[model samples]
Target: MGFIIKLLLTGAAAMLAAYVLPGVSIDGFLTALILALVLAVLNAIVRPILVFLTIPVTILTLGLFLLVINAVIILLADYLIAGFAVDGFIWALLFSLVLSVITAILDMIF
Candidate 1:
């Protein structure tokens, strides 16, 4: 299924992020898979509400508030998944950006 493939790509992206970014850490492939699944689920269920609630601020900030929204979600993923961690809010933000772009790229390529 496309959804499962996306999750796998996301897990791969997380692994790549851990290798590329000092601020991100993963215990192993299992943790990467768990983190990816948590992130995807949270993004599906919680992200919509958060986005709607922050719409005014997001609009006011000229859509830049999306960066903060992303950081929060990454932080959530870090908290929910054992053996996977982001160093701080800044790290979470950076990880989210890198992970998202990498996942998109990998999905397109493979």
Candidate 2:
């Protein structure tokens, strides 16, 4: 199904981020897959609420605040997932950015 493809792509992106970013660590492909699934769920359920709550600041920052939201989501995932780790806020931000870019590229390619 399409969802499975997306999940695999997201896992690939997470693994790619782990490879490129020193501060982002994923224990293995299975951990990356789990992280991807958790991130998808959080983004679907929690992200919209956070985005709605931060609308004022998000508008003031001209949408850049979404990066912070993404980072927070990553941090939350790191906290919940034992095999996934983000060193700090900066690392989370970078990992989120890299993951986004990689996923976007994969989406486009496939």
Q: Evaluated with TM-score, which candidate comes out highest?
A: 2
Model 1: clashing residue pairs?
Answer: none
TM-score of 2: 0.98
TM-score of 1: 0.96
Every candidate's lDDT: 0.90, 0.96
Superposed by TM-score, candidate 2 places the C-alpha of residue 75 at a distance from the truth, in angstroms, of 0.1
Query: Per-residue lDDT tens digits of candidate 2, residues 4-110?
Result: 99999999999998999999899999999999899999999999999999999999999999999999999999999999989999999999999999999999999
What does candidate 1's lDDT look like per residue over 1-110, in tens digits?
Answer: 98888778888899999999998999998889898889888989989999999999999999999999989999998888889989999999989889889988997799
- Model 2, poorest ten-residue lDDT window? 16-25
